[model samples]
Target chain A: QKEVEQDPGPLSVPEGAIVSLNCTYSNSAFQYFMWYRQYSRKGPELLMYTYSSGNKEDGRFTAQVDKSSKYISLFIRDSQPSDSATYLCATGSNAGNNRKLIWGLGTSLAVNP
Target chain B: GAGVSQSPRYKVAKRGQDVALRCDPISGHVSLFWYQQALGQGPEFLTYFQNEAQLDKSGLPSDRFFAERPEGSVSTLKIQRTQQEDSAVYLCASSFRRGAPYNEQFFGPGTRLTVL
Candidate 1:
């Protein structure tokens, strides 16, 4: 199984709708969970970051991590057309001395007006 | 202020050709990273550099792939005898902090390489 698995979705939603994106991982050593947004032809930008097994809120976006289940989620409340982009989940662990991150395939989202 | 800049935004080369990609990181950033992003997939780590030192390069797919940050500010990823499978978007990122506990990385637009 892949270390990280995310549904490569082209999820379409209306503006102001609540959008939920999730990812699952098989590694237990992953301690930091992060969310990134990437526009077409642009590099990924960090959106939300969390290090615990609870929910973290930042304005209209919330990120949740469940270490017990090896699951992570990003929730967009009252989405906007600008939110139409690819969402990627990234995890990092201190395996030995390396600190590179493991990334998911990313979920493509489109919020229409 | 510039975030991160990568040269040769798009490149096309025939198989067995050698190509060099360049990255100019944000000034004074302590860490630099290289990642390969395949179509429809997220970026995968290729190598990491701390200043002029290469701490870890185990993620490099093969010996033909080499990266160097000689002055610790600009980096170059050189692929020798490139294969069709080497075609992908190469991304460069830089962070202000080290140790990688939770420093946010600033990424460049990336260089897309197509091998024929």
Candidate 2:
């Protein structure tokens, strides 16, 4: 099985709607979960990061991790056209040599105004 | 550079040609990383450096892929005899801490490499 799996979603939603993106993993050792947003022609910008299992909120974005189910999610409130981009999920067990990052295929999201 | 910086923003190379991508990390950052992102995929870890010491390079796909941080601040990833399969965006990232739990990697505007 792929270490991390995410549906590359070209998901479209009306502006102001709530959006949820998700990913699942097989590795039980991942202690850190992160969400990144990427625009075409740009590097991914870190949106939110969560350690262990819980929810971390940053303004319009919320990241939640369920270690029990090996699943993680990112929720966007009041989504906007500017929020249209690809969302990627990544996880790692350590830093430095532990810098190994398992990634899923990013989900493409379009918030139409 | 104030933020992590990458050069050439875009590069197109003929297959079998060599290519070098550069990155300037945030000043004094202790850790540097290289990642490869194929279309529609998340960035995959390629290698990492702690200051001038390379700690892990196992993520490199093959011998043609090499990265170095000579002065412990700036880094470069070189692809020798690049192949069409090597076409992807090469991203560089840096973090402030030396160890565990502080690995929040601040990224550069990656260099998109296309091998034709």
Candidate 3:
């Protein structure tokens, strides 16, 4: 099984809708979870970052992690057309010197007007 | 301040050809990383460099893939005898510090390599 799994969604939603993107991992050693947004033909930019479990909120976006279940989520409030992009989830462990992240296939999102 | 920048924004190579992709990281960043992203997929780790030292390269798919950061600044990823499956976007990222929890990597626009 892949260490991290995310639905590669072409999820379409209207403007102002609340959007929830999620990912699940099989590795319990993962300690850091991150969410990134990528536009077409562009590299991904970090959107939210969280360590361990619990929740971190940044303006209209909130990131939540459940270490027990190995689940992570990013929620966007009042989504806009500009928010249309691919959302990728990544997990990292503190083990050893290899800090390489395990990433999931991104979910493509389109927020229409 | 400029973010990470990668040269040869786009490249096309025939199968079995070699290609070099360059990354100019943000000045003063201590850590550098290389990732490969295939179509409709998330970026996969290729290698990591702390300054001029290569710390991890387990992600390199084969011996044909190589990366180096000399002088602790600019880095290059060279693919020798590329295959059609090698077509992907190569991304570079840099962070101000070493390791996670303290380092937040800023990514470059990436180089799109098309192997035909």
Candidate 4:
């Protein structure tokens, strides 16, 4: 099984709608979860990061992790046209040689005005 | 402060030719990383460096791939005898500190390499 899995969504949503992006992992050792936003032709920019489980909120974005279920999510409230981009979920562990993050195939989001 | 930057935002090379990609990391970041992102895929780890000391390069796909961060700042990834399968975006990232929890790597605008 792939270490991390995410839906490669070209999801289209209207403005002001709520957008949820998610990923699941098989590794139980993953202790850090993060979300990244990438626009066309640009490198990914870190949007949110969380350690362990629970929720971390910054402005209109919220990141949630459930270690028990091995699931992670990024919620975008009041989505705007500016929110149109690809969303990637990543996980990391401090164990062994896991200094690098395991990434999922990003989901493409298009928020129409 | 400036973000990480990469040179030759785009590169095209013939199969069997060698290509060198450059990365200028954010100043003073002790940890540097290289990743490969194919079309429609998330970036995959290729190598990691702590200053001039390379800590992990197991992520490199083959012996043809090599990387170095000389002087503990600027880095270069060289693909010898590039193949068509090597076509992908080569991304470079750097973090402020060492270890995992602090590995919030700041990425550069990757160099898109196309091997024809």
Candidate 5:
């Protein structure tokens, strides 16, 4: 099984719709969960970050992590066309003395007007 | 102010060629990272550099892959004798972390490499 699994979505939604993107991981060693948004041909940008199991909210975006189920989510409230991008979920663990990052295949999202 | 800048935003090379991708990180960032993003997939970790030293490179795929951040400000990832499988977008990121405050990596506009 992949260390991190996210649906390869080409999810289409109307503007102002609430968007929920999720990911599941098999590695319990994973501690930090993060969400990144990538526009076409651009590199992934940091969107939300959370540690362990809890929820963190920033403006219109909310990130949730469930360590017990090894699940993580990024919720976009009142989404916009600008939110039409790939949403990638990634994790990191301190294996040795530094960081070991693991990533999932991103979910491609398109919010139309 | 520049966020992060990568040189030669697009590169095309024949198989067995060598290519160098460059990254100029944000000033004063302590940690740098390299990742490979194949089509339709998220970025995969390639290596990490902290200051002038490369602390962990276990994620690097093979001997053909190498990265260096000699001055601790700019980093370059070099791929030697590249194969067709090496065609992917290479991304660079830098962060400020002492022992791990927050791994909120700031990424550059990647260098897309295509090998034919």
Candidate 6:
């Protein structure tokens, strides 16, 4: 099984709707979870980052992590057309030789105006 | 401040040919990383460098893939005898400090490679 699993969603929603993107990781050793936004033909940019469990909020975006279940999520409020992009989840471990991030298949989102 | 910059924004190579991609990381950043992203897929780790030292390269797909950071600033990824499967966007990222997993990596626009 892949270390990280995310649904490749071409999810479309109207503007002002709430959007939730999630991923599940198999490695319990993962201590850091991150969300990245990638536009077409562009490299990904860091959107949100969280360590261990709980939630971190940044403006309209909130990142939640549940270490017990190895599940992570990014919630976007009042989604806008500009928010249309692919959201990727990545997990990383601080242990030996495991510094590289394990990424999941990104979820594609399109917020129509 | 400029983010990471990669040269040859786009490249096309015939199968069996060699191609070299360059990355100019954020100045003074101690960590550099290379990732490959296929169409409709997320970026996959390729290799990482801390200064001039390559701390982890286990992610490299094969011997044909090689990356170097001789001066600790600019880095290069060389693919020898590229195959059709090598076609993908090569991304370069850098962070201000070492132990990259804990830091946020700023990425370049990336080099889109097409191996025919």
lDDT of candidate 6 over A6-111, digit per residue (tens): 9998999999999999999998888899999999888889999998689999999999999998899999999999999999998887786455778999999999
Candidate 4, residues B1-116, lDDT tens digits: the string is: 69999998999999999999999999999888999999999999999888898888989999999999889999999999999999999999999867647469899999999999
Q: What ordering of candidates by DockQ runs from best to worst?
A: 1, 4, 3, 5, 2, 6
Pairs of residues at least 3 apart in sequence or in different chains that clash in candidate 4: none
Q: Point to the candidate with the largest lDDT.
A: 1
Model 2 ranges off by over 4 Å: none
A2-96: candidate 2 lDDT, tens digit per residue = 89999997899999999999999998988898888889888788888898788888898989999999999999999999999999898988733
Local accuracy of candidate 2 as per-residue lDDT tens digits, B17-95 = 9999999999989999999998878888899899998899988999999999999999999999999999999999998
Candidate 6 chain A TM-score vs. reference chain A: 0.97
Count: clashes, candidate 1:
0
Model 1, residue pairs in steric clash: none
What's the TM for model 3?
0.98
* Each prediction's whole-model lDDT (CA): 0.93, 0.90, 0.92, 0.92, 0.92, 0.92
Q: Choose 2 or 4, whichever is better by lDDT.
A: 4
- Per-candidate TM-scores read 0.97, 0.96, 0.98, 0.98, 0.97, 0.97
- For residue A84, model 2's alpha carbon misses the true position, in angstroms, by 0.6
Q: TM-score of model 5's chain A, to 2 decimals?
A: 0.97
Please, what are the lDDT tens digits per residue for candidate 4 over residues A38-96? 99888888999999689999999999999999999999999999999999998888776
The per-model DockQ list reads 0.76, 0.71, 0.73, 0.74, 0.73, 0.70
Task: State which docking tier applies to candidate 6.
Answer: medium
Report the number of the highest-DockQ candidate. 1
Model 1 misplaced stretches (Cα beyond 4 Å): none
TM-score of 4: 0.98
Model 5 lDDT tens row, B14-76: 999999999999999999999999999989888998899999898899999999999999999
